[model samples]
Target chain A: MSGIVLPRRQLIARAGGLVAAAGALPLLSGCDAINEAPAVRKILSMGEEMHRASQRALTDRDALAREFTRADLSPVFRPNGTRLPEGEAYAAHAARGFADWRVAVTGLVARPLSLSMADIRAMPQRSQITRHDCVEGWSAIGEWTGVQLSRVLAAAGLKDSARYIVFRCADRIGDADYYESCDLVDALHPQTILAWALNRQLLPIANGAPLRLRIERQLGYKHAKYLSAIEAVASLDGIGAGKGGYWEDRVDYEWYAGI
Target chain B: MTDLPPAMPPVRVYRHRLPTRLWHWLNALTLLVLLMSGLMIFNAHPRLYWGQYGANHDRAWLEIGSTRDAGYLRVGSWKVDTTGVLGRWTDGEGATQRWAFPSWATIPTRYSLADGRRWHLSFAWLLAIALTLYMLWTAFGGHLAKDLHVRRGEWAPRHIWRDIKDHARLRFPAGEAAARYNILQKLSYIGVIFVVLPLMIFTGLAMSPGFNATAPWLIDLFGGRQSARSIHFIAAWALVAFFLVHIAMVLLAGPVNEVRSMITGWFRLPPAKGERA
Candidate 1:
């Protein structure tokens, strides 16, 4: 009886191992297939929308991200993604301290304006020390000083038809220049700024020098750096892959990255 | 003496309600997806730190990384080589992939933070909503008082000690006694339901930048965002441990009977020892 029971148990265990191995192969591929399915992807994306709507509903529109004092600042703010833009065009601007660089405000605006570095500096500047959260789950605190994006949008006179503000960058990733967008809620948020300085010094080239968007409430990717243009549009259609931002188009990152 | 009457057939009794059974399965699926996808997300930055802010330049309390020929997990001053399992492992193609967790353990079966976040965040809604409903039902629907509530005497140290000893010895109760949860079972269920699950949800929310703005008090509650993240990771493992022990207990008590109780709400009681047919 012992002999029979022991052999059967061993056989069952071996069969179980074989079954698991066979099952796992298909299971892994099945997961990938489900992930790649357009219907499944669309349903998953609804979670992002749900998060955005729920957050908006729960909090005041003007609620602020926590601000840190100077003492709480990270000693060195680590730079991520396109530390420096490529090409002789960016090198020439950087070599001359970006004096000739201009950020053009165009599209769906009452007045299109090409403002240089000096023009930006003359505008009322707002400085903030805020946490920069990366999508990879790390964070760094730094001081950013620049003109409020609301002030710039107001000066340019945003057309009533405008629904999204798209930022074009000097950095070319892959075949296209990096770009990002946000709706009026974040575009006109007082904390949103086109920062030109970091940690009480001129922003380093590694950290989007000369100009960058500081959408304090969003993740690092939403803060487009190496600014070249700011376009306000009635719709995000016809943009790169019709997504609001570069990563959103390329890797399916959530357009609204407030999470 | 006259021969004893034939032993009575084992009693088949109702052991679980519909809501309990439904939630049990739903939670099982939700937790598995959350854990797998979460591991994929962790692969993005396989390090844990404390305080309000931490990044590449800041020191990490725990990290999983690979060197030239070896994989390691470092917890503060201590380090262990986890080669061929964690930090570094071979994929199905026999290619040596260096990631914090192996491919089989992640949701996509490949490294894709974007896909991982989508899976994690999507199922996170299921976890949160189900847990809320389950808790509400448990509290107001008499499941708590009827099934899980500790009676007067069960609170005594001796009573708890006896339960622990019985569990350690695999002396699970038989007959009518087996129908109810013992003290140890009651405590663990209460802990997981009331404490651990809520902590997972809150710490998860605390990591969200948007949620941080909405409720900065959450950060303060957990000491900091990074701290919340660390606690979240630790609680995930705690849930895994609880799952393992829970499975073992089921198998020990009687897999067929236990599983049927959860699935079909019917359990066949084991006869008490020394009973004769």
Candidate 2:
């Protein structure tokens, strides 16, 4: 009952510490409006604990959210983000049918690769009828076929030092560029893919065309569109804003935006 | 005046009731939990963009990224590492493992997505019920509208301005309930109780699969499912920020007297002379 410690502070020599005594009395009243109610705080803490527990419980990349059937596709699969890249570089790539397009896989790797659109298409592929969960609150189910990200990682070879995978993009939001990332587990996930086509067609400009990541297990933002390059890194510290992604850097988006 | 017969006080003018006390304090506590847990959840997948409330190429309602689900998939043994650590459950004697992500900032997940779904949904129910009951009782019993309703006096521009000034000073003025609550308190309480919480609850339901069909109006209200998700997260952050600041204020304003009134439903007073209420 007696175990209590309160840090004491001086009101200071700056100005009048005036009426410090009156303030002291309310300090004695527990559950004063100034203080958080214990139960609510407990719930808040509990919520945090639950989240921590969830993190501790789930981590294997192999276990995937069940893939749905083709009938599950939304009547209207609204596209999110830039429908089409605006800049000359993107326009040039778009014009060429992205045939000459190349995706560079560098940064902390054994042997970095610069793969062409054809090269990516040639890799053994898998398709899943899954939902595209956009941050904006709509979901569209589409059958996406592409090379398993794990296979590409195996070929490009990630170094031990690499802890994060960054996707450099060709799209820009406002002034900053579009980039996103994931950790090794997510990076190595079997369902994680870089799809060049959506619903049996080369993805249109509205839906991350030519090449866009369909990180099936995650929300859409992690699926960096307008694919330009990918980098693997040890820590997110040195990257843009040291947080890992483009939106994360400019806006306040969290680094590990796992769904 | 007491010498005559010390007449029994003419029916107690005001007495603190335990139920009211419990409701108030519980409300306070639950809000705190909701905010923190909400923040931890947001931190796990921090990304927001502005646009129309739809499933269009522009705006989004929610963003259920890999982190939200994958972050919670840790199984059996979970560990935290320097870079960051998360989990996964191995089934069939490690022959197979499902669910995995790497992160520390995320609110801790308890199990696979299914488990998370159960826990989160259940807790959401708990909050929904508690708030609902509290609101109903307060409304029917005339407790909330009577005690907390912003009056003409409170709404008066001068008083409101004064409260704003006092708040800017980061100190309540010397008066009844000045230390207790002033105009600003009403604003926040009203914001949360009347506005934010409902938005939170409704948006949550809007994103939920069970409610999508039953409540089509909700879906139309926020544009789409993803938009609801975004609103949910952003609004969550706002509440979390409110809570952190609120807790810091409690520590600053003196937690004892504050806690006591909510706990005991009584305040050893300075009377209206000094008390701001």
Candidate 3:
């Protein structure tokens, strides 16, 4: 009698385990289903907007990211995403120390200027030792030297209609050139610079040599490297996939990558 | 045969409050999503370090990576092969995948940092807001003072030791005594609610570059951004440990009664040992 009862109980327990496993399969798939739902995605995206809004409301417009001393700088600031641009144009520019490369300032600007590397160097320069926080959760501190993007915009005389500043980079990943955008507030911030030097030396080729955007408050992806052009626009509606940045367009990365 | 004596009816009591029950379930869902998605995020960079800066060249205190044929986890000088479970694993599609965490353990059940962030940040708001409201309720709504407060005598070494010994022996409080939290339960609950949860929230905020600008002191308080990140990872595991023990305790104490109390706020008390009902 005892043996018969024990076997039946064991069978019941095994059946229960099977039922649990079956239930778990649906639950996992349900998570995927909920993730794919468009309405749910929209709600999730609101968190990004809320984060941006709350951060803006809490901090001063000109609030600075923490700057580290030289001693705190990483021995090697790891170069990420498009270390080197392809094709003869970038190669030729690199061969010549980028002396001939020009960063065109166009779109909604009173002065549509084509500034050479020399022209950027002649402008007022600011050097800052700051931490570069990557979206992938690594950080590196480096000293960057460049002309403030605000100073460049001032030189170009931004039109009243201009609400956004778009950065065009020489590096192309997949079909289109790497690009990024920012609102006028970030564009005009004192720490927003077009850095041409790193670690008090000419920026390495792998590290977006010649020129790169240093939007200090944002993540690494927002700092467009190997800059080719800067455009002032009223809206990001006509930009690449209308998301204001390449990764933002392709991978659903938040445009305001402050976090 | 003589007729069996009538058995005693179990005593039922309203144990968990509405706020506690609601927050407990909400937190369960929120924390699960947060942990899973957080693992996916960690897959992007499966290394951790200390101080202000840490990158590929800098020495990582912890790393999970693959080399040719083997997947390994390294913590300081110690290393272990974690091939099938972590660093490398086979996905649902029967393809070998190398990532810090397995696909089943991540949300969307695949690798997508963007989607992971979406789920994490969305639930984070729910967690933060719910935690704030729950903490306020616990503080001013009399939940803390009445239900969780330890009497002066409960703090005595003898009393605390007795409770610990009882737990070790699996000798749970019975009858009316089971309704109130013991000193250990009260202390652990207080530690989790007031200390660990808040630490998780703050450390998470500290990792954000944007928030760092607004509250640089947070980084300073945690030693550095990377240090804050390490602490965040450690605290996440601490929570996982807490959850495992919590589930085990529920199962041991009587899962049906414990779960029903959480869900419906009514618990049936177990009768005292050697007592004739």
Deviation from native of the Cα of residue B130 in model 3, angstroms? 0.4
Native-contact fraction for each model? 0.72, 0.09, 0.74
Could you arrange the candidates by DockQ from highest to lowest?
Answer: 1, 3, 2
Candidate 1 regions off by >4 Å? A1-24
Writing each residue's lDDT as its tens digit, candidate 2 over B173-272 gives 4334643446777688678766787888888767543234234567569875556767777677777777777777666665765566567765443334
Candidate 3 wrongly placed segments (more than 4 Å): A1-27, B1-6, B274-276
> TM-score (0 to 1) of chain B, per candidate?
0.97, 0.66, 0.96
TM-score preference between candidates 1 and 3, better one: 1
Interface root mean square deviation for model 2, in Å?
Answer: 14.7
Q: Residue by residue across A1-259, what tens digits does model 1's lDDT show? A: 0000011322433454444456547778667667776799899999899989988887777888898899999988989888878999999999999999999999999999999999999999999999998888898999999999999999999999999999999998757788999999899998999999999899999899889999988888999999999999999999998998888877778887877
Q: Summarize candidate 2's per-residue lDDT along A1-259 as a digit string, tens digits.
A: 0000111111121111232233333332222221123454344334434433444354443556446677655555667667877888878888889878889999998989999988998899888876565543345667888988778878988888888888888877666677888877677877789888888888888887888887755556678888888898888887777766765554333343333
The residue pairs in collision within model 1 are none
lDDT of 3 at A105: 99
- In candidate 1 the C-alpha lDDT for residue B214 amounts to 79
Query: B4-53, model 1: which lDDT tens digit per residue?
Result: 77778888889899999999999999999999999998988899999998
Q: For residues A1-259, could you state the per-residue lDDT of candidate 3 as single tens digits?
A: 0000011222433454444345446666567667766799899999999989988897776788898888888999889888889999999999998989999999999999999999999999999999998988899999999999999999899999999999999998767889999998899988899999999999998889889999988888999999999999999997888999888776678899888
Q: After superposing the true interface residues, what Cα RMSD does each candidate give?
A: 7.9, 14.7, 8.3
